[model samples]
Target: MQTSSQLKRLGLFDARVPRYTSYPTAPHFKPGIGAELLPDWIRAIPENEAVSLYVHIPFCRRLCWFCACRTQGTATAEPVAAYLDSLKQELATIKGLLAPGIKIEHLHWGGGTPTLLQPDMITDLTHSILNAVPLADAAQFSVEIDPSEIDEARLDALAAAGMNRASIGVQDFDPMIQEVIGRPQSYEITKQAVDGLRARGINSLNMDILYGLPHQNTARIIDSVEKLISLGPDRVALFGYAHVPWVARRQTLIPTEALPSAEERLGLYYTARDLFLAAGYDEIGIDHFALPSDGLAKAHKAGTMKRNFQGYTEDVSKVMIGVGASSIARYPQGYAQNEPATSKYQAAARDGRLAGAKGHVFTDEDIARGRVIEELLCYFRVDFSKLADELSRPIEYFFTMVDGLELAMPGTTDLSGTVLSIRPEARPVARMIARHFDDYEMNESGHSQAV
Candidate 1:
């Protein structure tokens, strides 16, 4: 364990860095490419291969102060119905352009709260997406559930759509933290939500919780983790609370002074990590924990696990079509993001065009570097020779990049037989090290703390 002084020296508290969710991160995206590049990338999907789908639902009943996601609170279902229609239109447009015989191997419904949709709405949306791109026989379907918003009808609709896995949000069960964060949910309700999903035959579950919230001491987080463990979730995502008030205006409501210090934040993380590890959970990457029998664990063991907008994921499809407001789609050639506003996305979808407003076109160098960065962040080490061979670049090319690598995290990298890895104790600085391969300029204000 590092002391406060040691952490300070390493710039853990003061440094700002991208999460490397996408190499070139989202901030570097610009206009003009959406019209020119997105279609080319979509049309270029490899023949007959299954792809992944991500549908974003941006409506929520409540706005949690700590959340920085693109979402809006709605009082009724009128807008949701309109959004669903728009989503169907968007899928139809994509279907007309996409190559034939491609199927969806993984489908995810992320939200504001996917369960906010009424039963009929859920049924129609699922049916529409399937009509456009059918699910593969072994497709994995997952949705994010909100305990307060879910009920029998909503769950029934999801089950009918063949949702085999569900990821529930429980961002600290301590009443004080919940009150401060403006997302008050009782443990009983969450358990009932889990029970309901299980009753519907949802085989896998993932619970998301946060550390570094207001008034979150070690004991409070420990209690939350204990309760979470009792529910038998196959996976758990313990995320550090990113206080980006500049981006999400609602975060200004949170009392900044009440948050834990950097040292305390690390303590909170270690506390939860130790508890989860003792309970036989294998730590996957930096922030996720999974049981030994979970698919995430299997992926990690096989070195196929990947990081994306949703955090550590096992989805391996070469193409990911994100179809919703503010959704970012990933193609081998580049990244394209849908319009962020609900009305804009709806309008674009209605017009039989993608909701793309901004994007980045990947160059050959960008693609090569993206691969190395992804491998480094996912595994804490990268087999440089393997990536170099895969990208058809010379091995010495990475040697020239090592100077920038050290600048990101001094004294943390080592080279041994083409394996480039961060020192074990410096794992928290992996994000910094990954930036070494980023060809884009750093936008300091567009990121969060290094830890």
Candidate 2:
């Protein structure tokens, strides 16, 4: 077995790296590619294409010290109500641009906390979105909800709005960890929230857990995993907290010295994985777990699983339509993001324009590399021979990238084969391995933690 010191030398517990959520992560998004060219781009979306939808609500009741998501805390509902108005206007603008009766295969509402919307706002927003881009018969609708933010009124609104799945935020139940992170929802409160959502017939649930936070350890993770199992969520995402204090200002409040070393972080990951597997959960990818029956696990078994900005998902729509502030939409042609600032996004939409800030237009090379990287990330292996045949390039030509990487990590060349793969035990280092296929090495600073 490799010692912790040895793994540290191998970059096991390095500072943050991109989650590989995308090949060219969001930080690579460049400005100057504004809404000037959106009309033609939106118009270019192929007719009859079934697309996915993502709506971002940039407000939270309270800010967590470790959170890196784009969100603001408010003392009153006035700002939230105003933001909803902007969302409605943005929807109207997008509706006019979209081809009518387009099939929406998947719709997701992600942070700052979609549950923070007033009951009436939830109803109106979902109604308006469905009216604009009708959901397909098989469309999957999901939303991220903060338990404290959920009430009978909001729960009813969510169901009425056609939300069939819910992802609850439960970073850690221990009071010490909660205090350190500045997110203080109790265990009972989370349990009640899950029970309440299930009682109302919304049984498809996901819970979020974290490792590598200040004061987290193997014992803490083991205890938390047991508690999570008792909660019986259909899926669990063991996210490694990414602390970029410079970028996410709230994170500065956390004391840097209290954080775990790289070796400890890797150990935490192994411990968590062992605990979940022993509990009968299937490891879906780098950080996601699900019961064997879950669609995600099933997708993984069938080789149809896909990775997106929201992490691993079963929704494989070719097009993803993002609405609301800081949301990103992915199309066959390229990726686009709304303005990050709330005021700027609202203004762009109120002015009847798509709020595209900066995004990459995919080239054939990007698509090819994206596929290879995604496959390697998801499965921990890639068939280079098959990829070469698909790209009409000799397999040896692709190995040149491997040769360049070999000088940095010689073990990789020996382990990788016609089917490039790392050892099963080296899954956490998967992102570091995938970087070999990245076309651009200059954009590495934006990546998050490597746990």
User: Which model scores highest in lDDT?
Assistant: 1
* Model 2: pairs clashing at backbone N, Cα or C within 3 Å: 13-262, 16-448, 16-449, 17-447, 17-448, 18-447, 18-448
TM-score winner: 1
lDDT of 1 by residue, 1-451 (tens): 4465665566554425677789788999998777567777888897688999999999999998999999999999999999999999999988888888999999999988899999999999999999989999979999999999999988888999899999999999988889999999999999999999999889699999998888899899999999999999999998888888988999999999999988898889889999999999998887899999999999999999988888888988888999999999998878999999999999888988888999888888788778888888789888878987888889888766665555555577888888888887778767766766676743453222242
Q: Which stretches of candidate 2 lie over 4 Å from their true place?
A: 389-394, 412-417, 442-451
lDDT tens digits by residue: candidate 2, 145-198: 898888999999998888889998888887898999999988888998898888
Poorest 10 consecutive residues of model 2 by lDDT? 442-451
Candidate 1, residue 143: how far the Cα is off, in Å = 0.3
Q: Which residue runs does candidate 1 get wrong by more than 4 Å?
A: 9-15, 442-451
TM-score for each predicted model, relative to the true structure: 0.96, 0.94
Candidate 2, position 373, lDDT: 80
